[model samples]
Target chain A: MDQITLYTWIGFSVFLVLMLVVGYLSSKKMKSIRDFATGGGTLGPYVLGFSFAATYLSAATFLGYPGWSYEWGLSNLWLFLAIIAGGPIGVLMVAKKVRKLNNGQKSLSLPDWLGDFYKSDILRVGTGLILLFNIFYIAAQFVAGAKIFEYLLGMSYTSGLLLIALIVVIYVYAGGALADIYTDAVQAFIMAIAGIGIFISGIVIFWKGGISDTFAGISHELAAQNENLVAVFNPESLHFYSIGAVIGAIVIQWAFASAPHLFNKVLGLKNEQDLGKMIATYVVVAALSVLVLFGGLYSRAALGDTASAADLALMDYIIWAFPAIVVALFGVVILAAAMSTTDGIFVSISTVFANDIFLKFLVKRNIVKVSDEKAEKIAFQISRLTVPFIGLLALLIVIRPPEYMGDVMWIGISGIAAGTMGPILQAVYAKRKAPARAAELSMFVGLGSYLFLYFTGIIPSTMSAGAVSVFIGIATINIASWILRSASSSEMGAAEEGGS
Target chain B: INEMLSIWLYGFIIALIIIGFSLWKWYF
Candidate 1:
């Protein structure tokens, strides 16, 4: 084998072994469903914080988004800005509230929280079902890992996909949430190092005189290729062609904090007091990670026409800029980025299936009867079984591989964000008990509108469709709630008048 | 030097401020 491949194999083997060891150790502590789902809410700020940030900065952010910046130039910075601001905003708005609601409870999943909050089984089950859309998002992560493996290790896409799936499933199944959090924290550190390395490398490559000069040089080079490339809102681009589109991108991304895998990190915190530190850590790490976007502009200016496909732009730059050993190590970092998010997502899907659907809904309804202890054991077993099931489902979707990894992931993201954003915001912040009917309507309208717009090509940009649907969802909830409240009051008044 | 690049810089700076303020508010 070549030196790069040999180093990569060694790095990957070591990383995988460390992860499996953590999983084995964590499994020993997994006595209850709570332990499996939320690490029994004993995780400190650093672990929860790093795991949250790592899950947020997925392969899509590290790999796919840079490719976008390479293709569209500075316009992609709008999305980055949204991400930098949105994450903290989402946490500020909801993290404390979620922790308060879940305090002293047996680790509530997002769906379970919603169900209990609204007192509606339908809402919980609906939310759980909507979260399943993450299967596609997980598939996108597989595609990204496979792409890197194909480029660096000369592995076939299918081989890489299966390999990643097997490794992720083994760890997640063994240790559940504890294993996921521990490994994700480690992965987050690796990602932070890689992000800093890539960002510094880009600056060093284009260091004409200083930062401004570097950007000027990149702008000049890109402008020479195509004037539109240097423009803030590339008229030719689908994602950020206008101010409206940029706003749409921001709106949708802001709601991305509501994603189950990302937001549920709050439930893992040791206490509500740790929330501030956790959010602070997450913001710092996420900000650092986003600097990697600069690699896109660097690659575009430096490689020019010889740059590889857009999705591979950053990878190409890494290979060209670094020595073989460094490149091999970066291969592991990229895998960390991919698997970190995928593993969190796997735990989430399994938890929802076992905790929300099977135990809460079915057993509570007596459709599946057992003693309480037996039910908990059954839920734990079912959660473990779900890891491979989801891995297999996601693997099937990615076998063909989509044209753009970002788009494939966005398909699921837009749907989930659209469906849950309104309800979650209302549930967390509303003064009164948020009407269940209103949440139900919001979810249906939000998800339905997004699917209609996405599949029918009505909006042309998934971000725009997602944003519009989120607005519709929020509107539907407010309007439906007001109408219901008024009607109920009127009915009460009439009955009182008749009784008098 | 490009207008778009300048806008991006400003936006990034503003984003940093927003994030900093958020952290301050949450902590204090």
Candidate 2:
């Protein structure tokens, strides 16, 4: 429509080309399935660290969250704290153990890690089924990113979604984990700069020539409407201050430690020492990302509650206040967030299906009839082929997403956390192994109860289904483990010491 | 300005303390 909008599109097109170039460069020199899946376990701390951060903050953080934060004010900081702490804190607690286990198992994927740890092909298949929900997960990121483009170009939502999905599939399909990790590192840098730019832009809008300006605290319009808009905690809601909110934060954030796509970066580290450095780098970068979180506060302060969709709160403000190029670059930041997340999810899902489900579970007793090297070559090809196929599957599922998402999104997330976190923690920390059946039952009961209590409204929506599901899963697992105690401790040392 | 800043500052302090305690307990 305007010259600036045209310039914005030109910048985005250049950015997309740059990303494709990175994908091409990373795709070279892949000798094995290991390279495709885990970057051959040779990625350094910086690459893996930024990759973790980029994938951890998805399109939701970029788009949906700020608008939610805009309405709620400082209460939104609780969610912000969750985002900054989730991956860093999770890694600080568990990454060393993850790397050590990687050494013990040489796991190509999280499902592989779980299967080997529990020694159950059935559990691996179950984990794979749970992760298949990445179709929605990938689409969730796509939807968030597309919403920004939808606003920017004034196009149909479907067109933006299709454009993003195609870009994610192409790069990930071509370069695998190598491309994902490297591009994620670059995306993290871009996001940090974009976040700072947004914060400064918001701050400058309120600037005045004299000693003081009426726009001192939130927008003049918002503060005029309700002075509580500037209050630290609007005692009525007590959002960030509530006990349930804090606990909910912990439960959802713990999923960072449990998610396959997020932590699979750890499985790609060059060495244990690098893993420690990765934690520090990841934490610092992600924690500092709070700058972007302030964009919502700025948006609310700059342009108070509007009739626009809550997700568009910040973007709408940016569109009105900033030049077209700044808005367009911000769009790149959103795309980076979505693409970083989608690429990782793509790699995780495709590799899980190819490596864990097809090769390990379906190849007749985890053994293929060929030399180890030849089997690995076939596995590599299968994983590469599965990338596009997995992308297509995700594309198809996302084509007709549920109109009423209901509790399905949160339920699915909590189920994944409840299902995997309990079993994985025990495998790494428990002195004695729980029966595989107990592990399997924990997943089913966890996922099932989350949906059941969730759908039945047994647990109030105020309380997280994830936290409830996790406790239920733990309870069921503890009882099951105690009752079905095995006499032998043969699998006791799987992820713990003495496994080899 | 101070009130809004104080609230967010408190949230950040509390979150950092949690991380501090965790790092000490796990790594120290």
Candidate 3:
């Protein structure tokens, strides 16, 4: 084959081997579910930082974002800038207290942490079910990865999906949380390098133009068609969603640091010593996010008008705009971004199922008779084995993707945000003793209100249904807890940190 | 590169200010 193709395959093979080695090496420490789930609290700041950023970006950020930039023009760049809000949210809001509470708790999963925080299994299960919607989103990420492989490497989508599933399942099952974090760090570096490489190449390619030039061209083209391209909130333009979408985006992004999976990195932190460095890592990664986002705008300006297919502008930039070698390298980065995330999702889900469902449900009810040692072994075994099960489900769902899958994910995330954000934020931030029932009520009411308003179209056109759910969720928590915690101090326990 | 870096720097500066204020509230 061609030299570029040959080199790319070699590079891809090397990356795959490196991932396997990281997982295998980290597996040496995998004596139990702690290593499998939370790195036994050993991850350093840089690794956790990179891993968190990489996991957050996903294949969707790389693939779908440029298409948005292509269609919408410069105003879309604001959304990417909005992503940096995660840094402060991670440090001030989530990480410090999460790390503080986690001290001596030996908590391994989000469910365990939240359950213990509120001392409610009902809350645990409810939140766990809500988080399972993440599986659908993760499944979508896998589909996007398979599509990327199909686009770049000329692989059949079916073969790519199967191969991707097998690889993620293998490494993640073996490495557990340690494997996911380590491999994610490596994947983050690959993404950052590829992001910059693609950005610079986009600028140099065919001397097409800068951000200002691109917007000017868009204005020129639009003017000829009796339209404008760069307004902040253009409802009439097919090129842009309403300005309200940006508000919705900012809310979603600002809350993004609270995604329980992303919070997995916080749980993985070793101690308070690494906190500042970890936060700094997030800042650096956030800076890089701005750069990569700029690249999206660049690609739109450079190649928007000529491409027959608007959505594939990114792929075209790599293929026609850059050299074959750049294409091959970027191809590896794209697939790496996709696969590494699958590995993290796999470990997270497996941890939830084995620790949250199997152990919490079965052992607590005395459905299984086993020693603590035997129980830990069973959970570890379950965590590893559940990978194939999730893989199978995702594969099946992908094959016959629901018509409303995108909307389903949107509603599910809003429901989850409504249900969990209020409770979790209250648990961490508020000192007042909200009753356990407060968490349960808030989750259900939040989700219920979001779904009710959205399905009934009662939500105002100007307002976000998700934000409304959030407001309702917070109000539910405050009102319910105020009522419950007042005369029920015995049940509430009134303890801020550990179990009273 | 300068522009991208500046935006991030300013954004992070704002982040740090908020973080600083929050920490003060938590401790003081």
Candidate 4:
């Protein structure tokens, strides 16, 4: 519509071409399936660290977080703190053990890791089902990215979704983990720059209104919500449910990076020491990202009170206060966030289906037993092709994108959080090892509960279903483990006495 | 008295150096 808009498209087109070229070049060297899936475990810290961070922070953070904060006022700061709490704890606790276990096992996906840990095909298949849930999750990311493009660039949402899906498929399928890591490094840098720019611009607006006046405005606006926005904690309020929602957010954010795609990055680290470094670096960087969450609150306070505030909060301010160039640049930043997340999800889903599901179920089914080398190679090849197929699947699913793309993305995140986090935490850290049977039971219970809540409409609309499901799932696992362990201990004592 | 004290201090210093070096190499 205008010169700046034309220039923005031009820059995006150039960026797209550059990514394609990189993808093509990276595809040229495909000596083994290992190379495709794990970058032959040669990726340096720069790629490993940033790729991990960027993949976790999707368009949901870039667009949806700010919008939600805008609607809720500064009180949503609790959610930001929740993210900070969960990220470091996860790194210090879970990551090292995962790295040690991954040694010598060529795990192309998270389910592959589960298979290695449990030494059971059934467990691996169950993990694959969990990954399949990510297909809808990844679809949500693509839809959100496209909806943003449609809203800002005047393109049809379908066209935008298709374009993003195609790019992700080609780049990931062609270059595998190599392209994803490199592009991730670039995307991470772009996000950091974009985040800083938005913060500074938003700060300038507040500065113009003067600090005191800004607070006065925010307080007045928050008054409509009963002036409880700045009051940090109110135990007996509807906001109480929302505040409690922070715990679920914390668990999900911490575990999201440890999902199949990103967790595989742990194995790709050069050594045990590097794994430690990755954890520390990732935790620190991730902690800093909480600032963006605060920036969202600041923007909300600056914007006037309105009911439809969530969707319009961030963009509304940018569109009005900034020049066309700055607005366009911010759009690109959101685009990068969406693409980084969707691409990782696409790669992860493909890896799970190809490596764990198809290779185990279809390709290697006839063999009574398979060699490690053959298993690794087949899993790698299947994983390599999975990227594009997943992209195609996402393209189809996202054809009719949801109107509330942000909520859709969170729903997907909740599915992973509830289904996987409960089982993973138990298997990794609980003093008693959950039997494979118990873990499997937890997965089903968690997934079933989430679906039930969604369909039955029993839970409050604003609360995350994953929060309730994970709590229930963990309870189920602990109870089952206690009963099974007690029975096994008694049987073992009887057997020992009989043998003596 | 001086020799024993110095020996104890030297061992502590060397231990600290080794631990510091190991951590630096591991993290950075």
Candidate 5:
């Protein structure tokens, strides 16, 4: 109806049409599952590098990061640092090991790797549950993107969600990994450009009137000024962890990077040698993370008290605080970042559910050592169908979202960090296998504790209470394992001496 | 040649050991 609305819809529609064409072309070449999920393991260093980066980032980075930085001041940068740590470390530490294990296999998903690791159908099934949790998180991202479009363009949220969803799914389904990779490369470029442009505009706003005067303008009308309206940090404030924030940041980032969906990107790398480049790329991207942090802080300084809701603050700045063209560019960048990430998570969740849970239990119970071609193709087909189903389910839940996109996501992360990270991390690091019973018990305890804490609101939402619970669960499993191992070893030693 | 190298290695080790003992006491 309105000029701005008309332009916004037109821009979004044109973008969607181009994406659909690309997706259609991508699907034509999708002969197998590897081609669907991992870009056929043939993605070059550059595409692979950016695709991986884009997959980890989302609207959360674009919209959520600045909102968070705006609210918490410079202290919020610590969380960004924690996130940056997770990406590079996961790539460096896990890449070689994952490649060696998945060796020459065209596996499409994380569950495929986990299924191989435990050599147990049951473990794969449990991993599927974890993947489902990941799906909830991904679905939220999709909903967030739609919400952004609806608010900015004055379209109905439902319509915007469906419009974006249709375009993303069509492209991803048809093009499979090819379309996802190519588009992600393009999106990454757009994201960088948008970040630089918006950030510069935010700076210019501050230059027009520095923080001292901006506060003076707002200080008259507003009583009890929001303490976080500035870029400065204060030690006495509870805005940062004090001591807990530092420890919490370290623990959470370690778990986030090690998340199966994020780490599975390693399996998609072109070669073992390419890992060096991947790690190098991660370092650069990690530094770029500071850009989002500064952007949010700068925007906060520009808007002052007028920036009420943190989530929409960045978007509001782009729309009202800048020119029409910058606003359009911002929308494009957010859509690009959000779509690539949402698709990756969607594909991952479906693949894990299909291959790890359904295929292992229902379809092929006795198949022990399936190769990449068989596994990847079968898993990918399952994911293609299931992703839309999962997307629809997410759509239903997001109708009245819990709060902002970042809030719901953090809670979901807490639930996952509590449930899966403990046992998985223990399994990886201990050089000793958890007893079957112990692993099962620890998972139950960790998952149950996290849910209890989240639902009851016993744990402050500030710290990663879920990751902490995971650590407790892991400790329980290791202690049990230690006791059992010691008793068995001593008994064997005594028996050998008697026999001699 | 292997034996000669081994003897040289022993001498270098003795001189290094003298330096290490001297440095350790001085630093402490």
Candidate 6:
């Protein structure tokens, strides 16, 4: 009934209508499970590029990360720098190879690509199971969306969560990956605009004379509040306390580039030729998107002790800095950021379940035998059905959301990155086939070591723990492969000598 | 203050250079 709420409703309604229209159009194009999963491998460079960047940016980038900047100060920028450099590099290392590999097999999902490449059903199913951790990441997005709705529209957290879940589930179920990609591209554009707006608003609020003066003034204000706040490596901070921790952040972010939802964007590109253009677009957009982090430092300087909770810092700043109409429009952009990632996650999780677990594991093994046509139909239906099922699971977690949305999301991200990064990198780049046993061992080591380090507080931060685990995994695979190869060769030599 | 500012500036400069080199080598 208030002006802000009224405008927000109007803006959000328009966004929802546009998204549903795209979903409806895309639904008509889904003739097979592959079409539902990977947009029939026909998306253009810009669409896939934007979708990849948008999915990576998410509410964490806009809402959660700004809060980190507000809480921890300039030290948080190291993580941002890591993402800027690591993301494109990760994509460059994998995208063209992934696209070429998938072209031959027409694999519909990340797990499917790995499983087929390694020729192991166990690897496919194991990776599929590991990716289910994305449920936690999705729940974190819901918490973010609910927080924005609670702040902007004065809706209860529960109502906001339910509304976001309902909207995302309906569209993704109807249109699948095609709809998710197109909407994600649009969302990425809006997020880019909002990112610029956030950065400029910080300058507009705190312009002393020029850019240098503005930054110095802000730094002085923060140092006045707490000298540790402006430190490049704040000793009190958990995430960026030491040089080791900063390097850990970079390594983990590089590993995150291999996450299923982000990496699988390569599968939708029309061909390898489009890859350079796609990666170029993604790098530019991602570079722009992270500019929103400056809002954190700005809010910290402006609000001082009165700043809201860490996750709420950016939202509170937006409310305080802008007028009602701009606030309302920003509300839409924030929702786009949250939904963009959530929908991509939904598509990725569903594809893993239907394609990797159900079709490949069960039908291929005769555990659920059926004619190929019937099996495809069942898998497609199952994939569509999975949207609401996982949405409901994630909704349950959001009902009792964690204290830090960003940290909670990283719990899942760290696990997936640690487990998959080693095997995936090796699969894409290795000249000789990595032993399937080595891949499996590396996954367990990566995941197990990450859990041990995280829970025991040895590493003390999820990103650091995940980074160490990734190295352990890569090392495990190489050692195990070398040992196995040597042993087999020795056995062959011994048999030849005995025969002579 | 100068130290902090320099670190920030240099951090970004190094990151941009790495990204630029990567783009040229792999993407361009």
Best by lDDT: 6
Model 6, position A355, has a per-residue lDDT of 82
Candidate 5: residue A402 lDDT (0-100): 36
lDDT of 4 by residue, A1-500 (tens): 37556756876777667656655655565345435544636777656776666665666666666665665555455555555455545555566666655556676666776666556677688877776767776776686667557666777878889877776666555553333565666666666666666666655665535754654554555555544544444232222245455566656556654454356767767766776566555544554454455455555565555424354456666766678777777676666556666666666676666666766665667543667677777678777777777777767876875544556666666776677666677756665557777777887888789888765766533235667787888888888877777787797774221110
| Ranked by TM-score, top first | 6, 1, 2, 3, 4, 5
Shift in Å, residue A106, candidate 1: 5.1
Residue-wise lDDT of candidate 3 within A1-500, one digit each (tens)?
26656767777899878766655665575446434534526667787777767655666566655655555554455555556664355445666666665565666566777787788988878877776666666566666666655566667778877777676666565553334566567766766776676666654543436755643453454334333335455453232255555555556555556644356567655555466566667656655654565454555555556643334567766676667777777767776766766666677777787888778967876888888889999998987777888888777767743322233334545666767877877877787657888889998998888778777877532126776777788889989977765556667677233222
My TM-score estimates for the predictions, one after another, are: 0.90, 0.82, 0.79, 0.79, 0.78, 0.90
| Chain A (candidate 4) TM-score to true chain A | 0.82
Model with the higher DockQ, candidate 4 or 5 = 4
**Local distance difference test values of all predictions, in order:** 0.78, 0.65, 0.63, 0.62, 0.59, 0.79
What's the TM-score, to 2 decimals, of chain B in model 6?
0.76
- Span of ten consecutive residues with least summed lDDT in model 6 chain A: A491-500
Minimum summed lDDT over a 10-residue window in model 1 chain A is located at A491-500
lDDT of 2 at A342: 73
DockQ of all predictions against the true structure, Cα-based:
0.63, 0.40, 0.18, 0.04, 0.01, 0.52
Model 4 spans > 4 angstroms off: A29-47, A170-178, A208-243, A257-261, A267-277, A294-299, A302-309, A367-403, A461-463, A489-500, B1-28
Per-residue lDDT value at A81 in model 2:
64
Report clash pairs, candidate 2.
A219-A301
Q: Candidate 3: list runs displaced more than 4 Å.
A: A1-7, A21-44, A174-180, A205-229, A234-244, A259-274, A305-311, A367-381, A400-415, A451-465, A485-500, B1-28
Docking class of 4: incorrect
Question: Per-residue alpha-carbon lDDT of model 6 for A231-339, expressed as tens digits?
Answer: 9898877788998998888888888886533456676555545777788788778878888888888889999867547888887788789988888888787777677
Model 5 residue A446 CA deviation (Å) reads 2.4
- For the predicted complex of model 3, DockQ is 0.18
Candidate 3 chain A weakest ten by summed lDDT? A401-410
